[model samples]
Target chain A: MSAATPPSAVGPPAPGDAGVLVIDCVLVTEILTGFVREEVGKVGFRRGVVGLSGGVDSALTLAIACRALGAENVVPIVMPYRTSSPASERDARRVAAQLGADPLVIDISAQVDAYFERLPDADRARRGNKMARERMSILYDVSSARHALVIGTSNKTELLLGYSTIHGDSAYALNPIGDLYKTQVYALAGHLGLPEEVLAKAPSADLWEGQSDEEELGFSYALVDRLLFHMVDERRGRDELLRLGFDGGFVDQVARRVRDSQFKRRPPLIAKLSQRTIDRDFRYPRDWGR
Target chain B: MLSDPDVLAELAGEARPDPVVALAQGAPRLGDVPANVDRHLELIAQAAERGADLVVFPELSLTGYFLKDLVADSAVRLEGKEISALARASRAVDCVVGCILEGDDHRLHNAAVYLSRGEVVHVHRKVYLPTYGLFDEARYLAAGDRFRAFTMPLPSARAHREWRAGILICEDLWHPTSPAVLARDGVDVVICPSASPGRGVGSGAELGTAQSYDVMTRTYAQLLTTYVVYCNRVGYEDGVGFWGGSRVVGPDGEIRGEPASREEAMPLHRLERGALRRARIANPMLRDERHDVVDAEMRRLRRRSRM
Candidate 1:
């Protein structure tokens, strides 16, 4: 009430919006930036490591961490396989150059081949998961050597559709763009002045040659986001979408994917017949240390 | 047709005068003893002297809202020395200002204590404490369960005119039950003492808007066909801020008086409750209740539950 008193909404970085993806990037960045500053203040950390996938999500995340933790505090890892595209390697370099950080290239083709040889006749999915975990193992070891936290790059779409390899690319100490959808990742990457090549490319895990997310997932990220907006945000039913001029088959397909992938969206479910479980069985977040 | 200057002069006399209520955005008090209350009390009385019958102050007028842990000590009981001072001060121009009421139960409550004709008529505590983001009111204050309205005898020695008034505190206005109960009791006017926080969530519900608060107040007013007076506190407290924006609406939900937010200013408005009786009589929102649709289902549920 006095002249000396300050007003609210002071120094707020960005206001939120109704579209979750548009505002989620800011929210995630704010949380991660805050986390890094607070964690760094509490203890000493040598640097931050990011798995640079030459994709918009990782590029945006890497850029954010580079800004928050400084170029010297950040180390970008580019782990390409022998079958991996040259463009992917070049895109990773472009991201590193724009981010003003050096990239550490670790070709995992020989390692992956040796891994399959040791256990022959392994399924492609199993081998892919192993590859993802192998990359995370390398990142963790390098993080320990550098005394840094592993910054994650998987965006909301990858997390939502279960497109990410568990403990592989999904493994990180903190994620700055995990809440943003894949489409929003490009938007934010543009906002942060990231390289055009990284933002415009078709997103790929690049575990093997000639693999694209659309081909594997049976739908584009744009269509997934649109269907998600209708079902999740608008809370519309399948019949309602059909009545609104949507193809019934496509609506049903997206709805099924949304329902099926919900498990990956949440923490691994634990049977809760006991007193305590891995889930929010107890009010630990609220009553912790109280 | 009554002007404010004419009303104040008549009320300024020692003898009993016509009835009036002054509404204002009582700014925040960052300390235990409110500095703003003392600073604005003189000016408020001057405004009251002009024609204000009863002065309505915002929620936590003496001490600011979001006082957090300070509510324990900052909240004074109606019988305390601080309220006694306010009661005595109300006698100067024969006007009442809102104050927090701490009861004997030892639970602090957000309340509005009214002083009229050198006496306390009624003290109404808030019935709701919004526990959503940035609000932990249930942690400090207890919710009041009673619904109350009082008749203030007029000053004229021979006149039979008496104003029946009802009171609600803060979040009480948000719920339909609070105002519905009061209006059902045939209250001439409903006075809401509120301390709404500033806009933070960026949802459809925009705080500090005339329409946002007005929708709730006027909806009840139109339903009951009674005058609604809303008084809100202004200024920042900790991280949550208050946007004053006090207003008075008629039975038809028309704005009679609108006060600016973020300032300590008084705007006196007049209402004749008798004029709304016909409006209520013609299209009664109260009388058309489908008891069979509501009560029957509730009774069925109760019988099935064996409660």
Candidate 2:
């Protein structure tokens, strides 16, 4: 399709169809790999460290980083809790092997359990949040040890819905696939020819036993990706979305999630008092000359 | 100048060869004027060695785009050493380079200067300051107020006739009036230096931004009947990638040559005056343009708007 053709003229993708979200993966791969290399190299780092969850997002990120900084320069760290799915680890290892990267496995069971033992009544959500932060801590520590920048794996679908923990899985030195949606991530993974096991598995954070992202969110990625592509990227109004045959309640819920999660997408707000406050009046790009 | 019957009669019998021009697609270091000057000098030398009569660099070739607060520190005066170096390098080959110019009134402007034979011939400040959507040029720099064309002397030994040229920095070319004014002024060529960011990655092989530019440049070349030279930058600046597919389009609206996207390159193409003459003779759009009608209508519109 030509870039000039608007989504409305082409007709919005159906609720369960994400064909419009399919991108030219070859062009996207070239752009993203160049982004990783230049952004990381400017900061004086030649290597990248990524936390692998055996999920499609992280696997694609590792593959792009390997292509950007070479396979030997990218380190895939797999951190799993005691109750985490064993198949996740196996798939992550398989992905690493296919990409010619050695996997470094670190179990967070002891540290997480020791902390939760104090609050024995804590629920699964609390434990999951702690585990995410703990994994982030280990990745940063490994980044310092190996002198590599920490690369993030959060996709646009999760980021807009605030599904991932802020400053935990969301924090990184640079992200190769942050702009891509979950559906597009799968497309790019297929283009890059990732491991078949990783591609075939169900999407999950592996935070707790029997945890599935779609099941917990009460909606499939295909449905929400189509909705967000219109509501967010195309700037469609609520009434316009309803006219296009989207569920009213589902639309409101997704809109609220995006509105409430605006804080997660930005730096901490600073009150304006001085003449030139940081990120306010005194603005500079992050890649300013050193 | 071509409108003068005496000049037209004098040029009817003389033979002039096409002038070879080079488009230098470079990635300047952010806020580093001295380093970028060195890079431009090297490219100018290379273009001269390759038998190019002129070389044009991308917008803000002396300092990278997205300067924001760095604009104050990176702004250079016309008398500064950086421009002086470029002026000296132009002695070997005429060059058009971009920089943040600090005017005598202490205001900075996004400016592109045409240098020839150790002297600055013309300085064109970008009149359109795009402030919306990923651009904040108006916040840090002052806007220019006019579009004017100047005579450009060709470096070809066989061609003694000077070509009337105009420089439109990136956003300036987007407004149709900017190029229309230059076309009315009898410009034979329009040179644009751009720092266009790649965006809208859909199902197409080319970037959406690139497609828009291709359509716009081709339309302008065909309508105005002038050679269009577009030189865009490449590489990343704060995660914004500048897609460099620099090319030269003839007066017939055909792309002569273009470089690969997202890479630094220098592609050369000769601008044939014979093609320009043939296109203008066949179309006669410029000769038949009614400027008096446009001027009267603009004044009437202004009066109505005020009322």
Best by TM-score: 2
Docking class of 2: medium
Candidate that scores best on lDDT: 2
Question: In DockQ terms, which candidate is top?
Answer: 2
Model 2: residues >4 Å from true position, as ranges? A1-19, B1-16, B156-158
- Model 1 residue B13 lDDT? 43
List, for all models, the DockQ compared with the true complex.
0.03, 0.70
Q: What is the Cα-based TM-score of model 2?
A: 0.94
* Tens-place lDDT digits, model 1, residues A1-290: 13222212112111221343343344334434544543442335747998887877778878888877897789999998777789988998998997789999998878889978878989877877887888899999999998988888887777766787766787876666665667677877886788888877787888778789888987677756655655765588876555444456667766776678777666686677777564444322211111
Residues B250-293 of candidate 2: C-alpha lDDT, one tens digit per residue = 89888985555678899999987778878898988888899999
For model 1, the interface Cα RMSD in angstroms equals 10.5
lDDT of 1 by residue, B4-38 (tens): 44334445643333355677666545534556457
Tell me the deviation in Å of residue B229 in model 2: 0.5
